[model samples]
Target: MAKDSSFDIVSKVDMPEVTNAIQQAQRELEQRFDFKNSKSSIDLESDKIILVSDDDFKLSNVVDILESKLVKRGVSLRALDYGKVQPASGNTVKQEVKLVQGIAQDKSKLVIKAIKDSKIKVTASIQGDEIRVSGKNKDDLQAVIALLRKEDFGIELQFINFR
Candidate 1:
């Protein structure tokens, strides 16, 4: 009898990489002439990033710097869920951006449903924050991968632990 192959589908962020990117952006903000005295700052909370600036233009500049640093560190922009900018005191504005790491409960269900709808001979189970898809044939697995890649989940995903 032949054994079935499997892979884990996940959306995970490397914390160290994210920290490095934040630090790099901070350094740039400090050294850049325009932002040096602009009183702009970036803060990373548990699940979100807060950007505060003296004005809208400064806020945009700060966001651009952060995005560039994230890209340099191999973090996809799609993983960043940006929120609305709110006005603060003294002509300042604040923006909160959430980082999507693991798949949420609703998304997990969607993934399973999609896999089942594909009519492939496979088993998909939601394991904690990730989805595990297993099948007897590698071709079916490849097709699943292709289907997943075509879906817009608003977060970056990676297939790992293929066996």
Candidate 2:
């Protein structure tokens, strides 16, 4: 009898790394020549990040710096969902950046469809925030991973729990 090879597909981020990135962004904002006296700030509240600055230009720069820090920390840019810039107190502008942490039901369906369309002789089932792929052949499981990697799901995907 052949045993099924399986793996889980997931999208997850390291919160500690995000914290470090935020701290680094704050330090840069303070030391930058243009940001001095600008009243620009960055705040991380649970799953969301708030960026505030005196104007559009400063706000844009702040976002750039924060994104760079996140990238350096190995956090994928695709995981960030940016909100519209709005006016804040004291004439400052603020933007909210939400950290997208999980694969939604809609996205899970898309992944399942992609796997089915690949004709790779494997089966995929949605498991909460992730998808489980299984097949009798290990080569088919690897092929599923490759196919998913080639498609842009607008979110970062990681394969784990291979067996």
Candidate 3:
């Protein structure tokens, strides 16, 4: 019997790189003239980033600086999902941005369902935070990759560990 080929589908982010980017952004915010006295700040929590500012314009500027830092650190914008902004007391605004790492349970199921619906003669299993698809033919797996890339999930996906 011929050896089967397989690939692991995952949406993962390097936390260390993200942390470094955040740190760099913080430094820039502290040193930048516009931000130095703006009373705007960026805070990184467990799974989310909080951007606080005196007003919407400052908030947007902070976001832009953070995004530039992320790009410099090689982090994809798709990995960071932005949430709606809300006004806080004292004429301030706060925005929460989520750092998505790894596929969630619901997304994993959706991926498997899509593969099955495509009838590509491949087996897809949802592992912890990832989906593994296997098939006898490499072409079928390549097709799967192409199909997945076309779908918009709002998260950056990477095809890894292909055999």
Give the top-scoring candidate (TM-score): 2
lDDT of 3 by residue, 1-163 (tens): 8999999999988888889998998898899888766778888898899998889898999999999999999899998889999997777899999999899988888888888988998999988999999999999999999999898876788999999
Worst 10 residues of 1 by lDDT: 35-44
Say which prediction, candidate 1 or candidate 2, comes out ahead on lDDT. 2
Candidate 1 C-alpha error for residue 109, in Å: 2.5
Backbone clashes under 3 angstroms, per model = 0, 0, 0
Q: What is the lDDT of residue 102 in candidate 3?
A: 94
- Candidate 1: pairs in clash: none
Off by over 4 Å in 2: none
Write candidate 2's Cα lDDT for 1-163 as tens digits. Answer: 8889899999988899999999999999999999888999999999999999999999999999999999999999999999999999999999999999889999999999999998889989998999999999999999899899999989999999999
Q: Judge candidate 1 against the unseen true structure and give its global Cα lDDT, from 0 to 1.
A: 0.91
Looking at model 1, residue 96 earns an lDDT score of 96
Question: Model 3 has how many clashing residue pairs?
Answer: 0
TM-score, per-candidate, Cα-based:
0.89, 0.97, 0.85
Candidate 3: clashing pairs of residues: none
